[model samples]
Target: MEYSEKKALAIKEYFAGGTTSTKLGLKYGFGNASVSRWVAMEKKKKRKFEEYAASIRAVREGMPTDVKALQEELRMARLNISLLEAMIDISDDQHGTDIRKKAGTRRS
Candidate 1:
C-alpha cells in the first residue's frame, strides 16, 4: 500500500477532528493498521525533531553541549602531564639522569 503526504494529512485532519482511527481508516479507504502506522511514524519524526531543536537551543544559550566528555578527556590529559613531569623531575634529581633538555648555554 503506497502512502503519501496527502494520506498523512488526511489522517492528521481526521485525528484532529476527534475521530478514531477505525472510523478515519474507513473514511480514508485504509485499514486501521495503516492509519496507526502513519501516526506512529509521524510521532517518531516529531520526537527526533524536538530533540534536535533542543540541542540547537542549548548551543544558542551558550550552554556547552556534548562537551562534558571532552572536558573529562582534557582533565585526564593535564593530570597525566603533571604526573609525568613529576616523575621526570624526581628521576633527574634522585637518579642523576641527564635526560632533561637544557634551556640555554651554560656560563663558564
Candidate 2:
C-alpha cells in the first residue's frame, strides 16, 4: 500500500515484458505519467549494473591471450559486425529512399 512498494511492484511488472506500463501503473495505483519515469529508471539501473559487472569481469580476467582463442573471438566479432552491417544496409534500403536518390544523383 506504500508508495515505494507500489513503485517496486510496477517496476517488476514492467520488466516482465508483456504488460504495458500504463496497465501496470493503473493496477498498482500509480499515475499513468509516472510509468514512463519508472520504466526509464529501471532501464538505467539495469545498465549501471551491467557496466559494473563488465568492469569486475575485466579486472578478474586480465584479458585473453591464447592465439587460437583470440582468433576465434576475432572471427566471431567479425561475423557479428558483418551481420550488423547487413541489417543496417537493409534498413537503409527500406527507409532511405530520398538519401539514396540524392547519392545516385551526385554520382551521375
Candidate 3:
C-alpha cells in the first residue's frame, strides 16, 4: 500500500508520544519496519525537498554531442549489462545463492 508523508509524520508523532513501532504499525495497518523507517526519516533533520548535488544540464555550451557515437555507447552499455547479468546468474548457480554484494557481508 502507498503511504503518504502526512501519514508518516502522524506515525512519527504517535511514536514520539511513547507508542511502540509495532503497536503503531498495527493500528495503522502497516508493518513495524515501515513505521520504524518512517520514524528514522523524521528523526533525521534535513531539507524537506531533494535537490541535485551536481548540474542538471546534460552537456555544457560549445560541446557538441554526436548521435552515432552516443548510440554506440548506449549499445555497448546494454551489452555490458547483459554480460554482467549472465555472470551473476552463473555465479548464483555455482554458489547456490547470490554471492555478489551479500547483505551484512563486507569486504575487509
Candidate with the greatest TM-score versus the true structure: 2
Error of 2 at 81 (Å): 51
Query: Lowest summed lDDT over 10 consecutive residues: which window, candidate 2?
Result: 98-107
Q: After superposition, how far is residue 17 of candidate 3 from its true place, in Å?
A: 1.7
lDDT of 3 at 15: 56
lDDT of 1 by residue, 24-45 (tens): 7887687888888887777789
Q: In model 3, what are the clashing residue pairs, if there are any?
A: none
Residue-level error in angstroms, candidate 2, position 32: 2.1
Model 3: per-residue lDDT, tens digit, 17-95? Answer: 9778788778777788987887777655333422232233344322345666788899999999999999999989988
lDDT by residue (2-72, candidate 2, tens digit) is 98888888888788789887788789887777987978988999999999999999866765546668899
Score candidate 1 by lDDT.
0.80
My TM-score estimates for the predictions, one after another, are: 0.51, 0.54, 0.34
Off by over 4 Å in 3: 46-108
* Local accuracy by lDDT, each model: 0.80, 0.82, 0.71
Q: After superposition, how far is residue 52 of candidate 1 from its true place, in Å?
A: 0.4
Clashing residue pairs in all predictions, respectively, total 0, 0, 0
- Identify the runs in model 2 with alpha carbons over 4 angstroms from their true place: 63-108
Alpha carbon lDDT of residue 45, candidate 2? 91
